[model samples]
Target chain A: MDSVFVHKMWNDHELSKMINQDIPFLMLSDQDGSIGKMYGIYDEDSGVETRGRFIIDPDGNIQGFEVLTPPVGRNVSETIRQIKAFQLVRESQGTEATPSGWQPGKQTLKPGPDLVGNVWKVWKVSEAFND
Target chain B: MPEEFKPGCQRPPVKKIDPETAAGISNESVLKEAKPSMVKVGKPAPDFTAAAYGQGKFVNTSLSEYKGKWVLLCFYPGDFTFV
Candidate 1:
């Protein structure tokens, strides 16, 4: 939980230097931990929220969420990969399914009766970890 | 009486569970209850309106405003936390 001023300074001085550009998305300052509590990330004792990430789709439904401790860091590349995977699945109307570690322009599976037991034959372990 | 403090132990007996105190603490006590997240996949994310900083500007932002967009919402412990 930080203030808008803190967010501004952090973004300008720290985040920008690391990424070479400011974060392109809205960065809300949950000073009171109210927003964090709503998302179940607020720690009452620390008065801070756990590092959390939520991917909400266009329909406003939470597609994925992750909460991690201080020592471990979240992955932006993984986030982007999941976003693309979710988008592909949504656009295909659930027909296309992404395997673990799926990336854009990679192979997507068509989920149906044919794919029920033949996943191993078509998708290799190498392809999923190809990237 | 903890097993390690029962006596005949090689190391010094623990007097207190507090690490800061004279007794060296051990991870034996029950911690806080771990509650599951309220936000679930495929469920509607709770709407929130808060003061926000984005792209070098301070503004009031809300979850509802991004209705037709895919958002990768992130929350960290605090500012200057290198995470």
Candidate 2:
């Protein structure tokens, strides 16, 4: 857990150089690991939180999450893609489902009995890369 | 055995709480203490209010303030680490 001042300096020094701009979102400080403890990412031994991300939906329910160790870097774009998928499914009231590696303006499966075994035919691997 | 302390005489009356109602986990802090583990999917994301450094200034923010839109909480190990 970092103090707010440390978050400020990190953004100013390290993050800005990588992203070429100040991060335009909240870099919250979980001092004393209260929030991290709540999310189960707090590392008591290190006095820091492990790498993790949580996607909370509009209704405050946790829709998705990723918890990883320090060795691997988490992908922000992948999280964004999943968020888009989640929004699409929620918007369609769970009727539509984005398949693996689904992107916007691509085909979405209408989950039903008809598409149960026939998904292989309707969803082609080529389509994933076509558009 | 200590004779003066527990001589089986002049003892104060015991006070008791109802075990059913005062199971101790009924309070939220107790609940949090009991389950200091993972956040579950479809469960309400833990609400938090904290100071944040964002967009050139320090401001106080909370998870509940962003209730109407999607929220991504990114947590890393430390401030100056490269990963």
Candidate 3:
């Protein structure tokens, strides 16, 4: 996913070095775009696969899915945040909901039928934004 | 199995898909059958043969050659960039 694409295209020496990497990462050639087609990530008009990340649960169900456009690099930190949030939800029956930009130790709101409109007030903040 | 149609034999009905309204699978059962075809988490990737150019030679490599070891399959649109 790094500059390896250039090597694949230009038939450079780095292609062999990249294929020899030890890290558990995949490098597939999508020249024909068939794999992307099966994943529904291929854009025929744009001629590129959308940057996508899917966190599949141990049971194989798609627990979280994110697709980012090329201009925006993926937020690895935010992805970890989402993973922790989902893990918390799975472990507890707490009715709390993670708010925008909510990280560890950030204030979370207890969601309920009656508290739907006032969920944001749980945080000690100055900005008043609507969801 | 004839290469060309001959005699009075009737051909099977042709199931036509209108190009104007080409769509994905509709039957849940058929989709279920298709579901297993995708690369699932923790499962072996499907076998493929592709030309790998390295060391000034382009040789065909097969997925089976990488068996018993982790493989990473990455793709990019084209080459030559600041990336």
Candidate 4:
């Protein structure tokens, strides 16, 4: 779902023809800035919404989200990484937590009371996945 | 659509109101009145229905309609603005 502060409708056919976006996604027009205000990204002074991205799970819960200033574009790869990490954790029922820079096919940590203070001891920082 | 039709050209023209009437309408007051409560992670997303242009027509859509799927709600400032 994509939301824009301005009310104008996108010419999807023209956009897809230009950008070649094969994926099907819903694009919404928050014409009155209602959704932007609800998401706390609306700038009343400028009458524009700041950049925002939210990853909502199947249950309608916001698993992860990022809000950026108007000038900065978001990282698509990072968003995909986050979604994958969240899905993995959800599949494990909260028993597993992905470490920093975790990606698919990488190792995950089994979160436990015993591992609270001994994270560094149990998981080697050198062995962690890195880009 | 005409060959000259542009993406942003479809927006409705803004209505011009009288200066005195416009002066009486405070944007700040309206903003304060329309401000929405902030949403948080781990909480339910605020539900809304909006008009979306897709597949060559305007369709009414809502957050609840995507309940059984993962949704990436991406909000941008406006159309045709460089990020």
Candidate 5:
């Protein structure tokens, strides 16, 4: 996992200490903001980056990504949830696709030629989970 | 005495840009040139190498190192700043 910050490495350490929790992931300092520029999140005027999150599959393909304004914070739990859902779908070899708000131990839909345009008839949204 | 709570007490002032300056700031065109031509879902992620702090050590790493594993790239504005 990558955590890119538009600051110096020293600031990264200081922030980590301020948070009182060790950042568990690899934290990169894009001081020149080149990475941010490449990702299309760099704000040239302010010399800062927007909050961007990308989920990549095992094959290095981007499975999903979200970009938020700098004033908005991202939801870590939601990111984890998406990772879990993506992993499950990848493990199933594309045979199954998770429905909206799907979680572990929930029913997954099997996508096939026959299941097209008839998903609602086979799977009931109310009966899928207790959420 | 209890202190009164005010919303946006610490919020920064919004920057005001003139119409002419704002119109000249075609950020989209600059971003398009900097970004990869084909950046989207199912496309290979842009690769880069940099020094990272992790596992209690500073090590040079690259996106290629995480091949064959699920990876999440989280980019934020700055350190110790409110999102």
Candidate 6:
């Protein structure tokens, strides 16, 4: 897809009316798929990358990344949730790992203090946690 | 014509089909016929020195040079395709 064609589409009366403001965008090409392979997103069978997206911090640490299989679109809401969760953790004292199905404003158990007790309390029903 | 065809067609089937014997062979036994060499991860990746277009000229780049920063080496069947 050409940027010129996108710009032309955006300039149309119906499309222009939907946008209330301008957004900054960056476009980089992976001609030889060097970066794609580095991130482990390149698929050899299709000769194209799987639908993978990464949110890397300025310091080059991968804050979050998601690889969606073919025939599935990315979940924008989940990505935004991850970004917010990461930002919140960065702001707070960092001593916790988010459990499965974790959400904001939930009780985050600190790993160092009473890990066994916490695990028993959290997963009382699991057979692995029993003894 | 019938006598000529009968003489030409009369022969025992050399390849015999044994369903019971064939059924004895398990999936794992069949797969063990050939073994493939495995590459260990976390051990150093294979190094290759290739002529790369860098700094406005073609120069040789090796895996040993980029030891500190993570290096992503990719190989395509060929260039000019959307791989």
Q: Considering lDDT, which of the candidate structures 5 and 6 is the better prediction for this target? A: 5
Per-residue lDDT of A1-131 in model 1, one digit per residue for the tens? 77899888988888888889997776788887888888988766546677789999999999999998655788888888889889999999998999875788888899899989999988889885755
lDDT of each: 0.80, 0.82, 0.51, 0.75, 0.73, 0.46
Q: How do the residues A1-131 of candidate 2 rate in per-residue lDDT, one tens digit apiece? A: 67889988989989998999998788888888889998998766556677889999999999999988755778877898989999999999999999876889888999999998999987888766535
- Across A1-131, the per-residue lDDT of candidate 3 in tens digits comes to 22334444554444435656432333445566665565555555556665656554433344565655544556677677777776665556567766666677666667778776775556645322332
- How well does candidate 6 reproduce the true complex, by DockQ? 0.02
Best by lDDT: 2
lDDT, candidate 4, A32-121, per-residue tens: 888888888877665777888999999999988898877678889889989999999999999999998788888889987888898888
Q: List the residue pairs that clash in candidate 5.
A: none
Instruction: Please give the C-alpha DockQ score of model 2.
Output: 0.30
Candidate 1 local lDDT, B55-79, one digit each (tens): 8788998889999999888888777
* Docking model 4 quality class: acceptable
Off by more than 4 A, model 4: A1-14, A21-23, A126-129, B1-35
Q: Candidate 1 chain A — worst ten consecutive residues by lDDT sum?
A: A42-51
Fnat of candidate 6: 0.00
**Interface RMSD in angstroms for candidate 3:** 11.8
RMSD in angstroms, all models? Answer: 9.4, 12.7, 13.2, 6.5, 6.9, 16.3
* Pairs of colliding residues, candidate 3: A25-B72, A26-B72, A26-B73, A26-B74, A27-B72, A27-B73, A27-B74, A28-B73, A28-B74
Off by over 4 Å in 3: A1-21, A26-32, A124-131, B1-83
Q: Please, what's the RMSD in Å of model 2? A: 12.7
Runs of candidate 5 with Cα error greater than 4 angstroms are A1-21, A125-130, B1-38
Q: What are the per-residue Cα lDDT tens digits for candidate 6 across B1-83?
A: 42332222112223555554678865554534232222233244434344444222334555556554433232222222121
Error of 2 at B37 (Å): 2.6
